[model samples]
Target: MNRKPADTEPVTNAPEWTVSSLSGALKRTLEDAFGHVRLRGEVTGYRGPHSSGHAYFGLKDEGARIDAVIWKGVFQKLRIRPEEGMEVIAVGRVTTFPASSRYQIVIESLEPAGVGALMAILEERRRKLAAEGLFDESRKRPLPFLPEVIGVVTSPTGAVIRDILHRLADRFPRRVLVWPVRVQGETSAAEVAAAIRGFNALPRAMNGPTGPVPRPDVLIVARGGGSLEDLWSFNEEVVVRAAAESAIPLVSAIGHETDWTLIDLAADLRAPTPTAAAEKVVPVRLDLLAAIADLARRHRGAMMRLGERRASDLRALTRALPSADNLLAGARQRLDLAGGRLVHMLGAGVRRHEARLAAAGQKLARLSPLVLLERARARWATAAQGLGRGFAHGIERRAAILTRAVSRLSLQPLRLRAEAGRERLTIAGTRLANARAARLAAERARVDNLWKLVESLSHKGVLARGYAIVLDSEGHTVRTRAAVSEGMALELVFADGKVGATAQGEGAQPATRGRKRKSDAAAPPPVQPTLFGGGE
Candidate 1:
């Protein structure tokens, strides 16, 4: 068999790519194929937003799952935020993450799937607002019986406004402030809310371009009938909150009577129609006038009847009174009887005075001055005797008290107390002295132990154990022989002291050798070990 040369090799046509290139190609292909798509699926694995303000989640159906991401800007603009288990239709471009080698959808816009989803969202919002007490009946205000200025929030061109105006005219006319706004669309809710707030912000009455613009006394938010989607603006949280926070009474007349919105719950009154809102705000002018007239007539008649009844009572009282002549006849008879009794009373008084004079004379004789003086003297003498006896008894009682006090006064008990106090003082002083001595001893021992520990850990201890340290002229430790050079200034520190010397090369001999030999020959000096090496 013939083998091909080593340099000769067979080659086939095939494309080559790096991982990044392949990923890029795949991403471009996927994006070009599905530039934009609307996918309806149930959201899953939604764990809210990341710290980066971007949201990550998965959209899955019964069988398949696709990763989804919402950029911060896009997520903030979304009307309906994606929640776990929520069914929504996402509109965005299909893209790939090269790092993870996965395909995902970059969501730009998201919304609930259909009417069912919308209803679910609506119910959830209702429950939330209700929990905040915004929809409570107690929070609702009563509509003004007669509003001077009425504000209508609706399209000025719509028939609803015309109906309201005509009805209000038929009943009691009022100043109407029309805040024209879009009835439906993306800006509908915001426009309506602004209109409500604008009306509230207006001064009670302010000058306008054409004429005076009076702030609305009663606000009527009215619109013609429509489906739930068309009427959804009234159900927005902004519009409902505006109605709830309205200072002036508000009437909600949106859609047909059967169609309910959240604003109706917060409004002061819910009219079935625009015309009904008008009727409810004001009473019928003619009927009111007629009622007033009837009341005036009844009041006048009642006052007249009261006056007549009082007059009759006065006449009856006058007829029942006694005749003046008859009254005078009785007075004359009493006067005559009084005159006859006056003479008899005068005679009896004189006789009674005589008897009183006789009794007074007898009392005067019995109370003579001499007899009174004698009686007073007898009483005085008796009192004097009683006082003497009392004084004598008081003196005897005081003497007995003095005798008892003298017996209780003694010196023996005081001496015993003084001795006991002295003994207590002595014992206290001895205990205090012992305690002071013990504290001083303990402190001394502690200080000695600390001093010993410091000595053991210090470098001085190493020097004392026959070890010496060598330092350069700069006082830096010379740990290796290489750090030394010929003629270098050196320092040697031992336990006893530090010595300065000039370094000599290894071949140099010691200067003290001759002196040391002479001394050694005379005394035969015992050998002594140097700090690092023995003498040569």
Candidate 2:
């Protein structure tokens, strides 16, 4: 304890260290010792990017742990950012923070430790989206039975588009709208999502450069088979969400049958390949035509069966009905018996009326006017003396009446009255004749107007427009080409007259009656390409 000045041997010369200098020296030594490390450890203590966009986290294994830092510039360039509890491989320089005198790894790059890490991230995302009900069966819609226009989201030059086009052409040709996009890489998810929304943004029907740009009734998001990382674009949340929210029914054909992606869950239907998606979108044209023909045959057979049944019933009813002669026999017999009794009944009625008339005449004779005349004569005799004066007064009154009649009577006045009556009769006759003539003229005009209306409304007026009515031998309309056959009798009624003709053959094409226009020979519309460009 007392050997400080002379007892100890002379100490070797050494430089003094300040705290900062010492810390700096240690930092340099750590950096020099482990210039860069490819450390594999589980990421911990990562909340997120700091305010300055730097990331500070810890890398820990079961045996040990170290502080790790990703600077703002390096973090921005990282493809995979550090997540808490994510096992990652970090390549970085090891140095000490002089202020705290602590050593940390300054990471330059970071990636998942292995495929297992990527799977972990994928499963976590799947669970999150599933919890939000994005992958529910109820949310999935049915693919259109036949999409007139099919929208495809895929690479423009890939075999997938060609296969889909070929398959669709083989089954049922449909107009295809291609939205070319990158199938993989950093920007794949965004491009694919934008393609889906862009398709949805198109009008249901609109005119484009060549023709109509009809919105797809159904969509196909497709790509050839590839590894999980290659197909990871479809599994991205943005892609999955776009598929889930699409109004158009979506079919996902991302990979081979064994391969699947998040889009497969979100899509309305999933196909093993692009060709299979084409098959699901439309039915075979030939098969549809065959089915329609079969239905037509069935309908005709049903109608014929019904007609035959109705005819048989009618025959049976006709046989059960009585003849007209049989029904009228009893009525005829009753009418003959009544006719025989009519004369006797009329004679009996006449005899009863004659007896009633004779009784009335006998009563009238019993109350005759001779009895009243005799009584009147006896009364007149008793009043004869008083009547002498009355008789004289009557003679005087008759003489005065004769004198007045002679004074009033005049032939000239009578003749004038008769002439006036004749004039009035003549005017009345003229007026009656005029009224009759006007009535007759109005009736004749009405009849003429009605006849003109009938002529205008007749079917002959339609024939006057250079059209002909074709009638079969049985006077039925031969409306369709199928109804005509070789040696079939036909009647063509034109404006002036009708002509009878025979059909030449089944394959004969009806000649065009009128002159053909130049536009009738114009070329057909151009075909649209199956794939569009602009893919990366």
TM-score of each: 0.55, 0.54
lDDT of 1: 0.81
Give candidate 1's error at residue 327 in angstroms: 13
User: Which parts of model 2 are misplaced by more than 4 Å?
Assistant: 1-12, 16-35, 51-54, 70-81, 205-212, 306-536
Tens digit of per-residue lDDT, candidate 1, span 1-536: 99889778878698899999999999999999999999999999999999999999999999999999999998876666787788999999999999999999999999888889878878888998999999888987877778888999999999999999999999998888899999887678889999999999999668989988888889999999997778888888999999999988899999888988999998989999888988999999999999999999999999999999999999999999999998799899999999999888878866765675566556545543334434444655575567557655655665466456546756466446545654765565566557656755764565445446545655778899999999765454666675566777789999999999888879433333112122212332223222122321
**For model 2, how does the per-residue alpha-carbon lDDT over 326-356 read when each residue is reduced to its tens digit?**
9999999999999889878768866865675
Maximum-lDDT candidate: 1
* Candidate 2 lDDT (Cα, 0 to 1): 0.80
Clashing pairs in 2: none
TM-score of 2: 0.54
Best by TM-score: 1
What overall lDDT goes with each candidate model? 0.81, 0.80
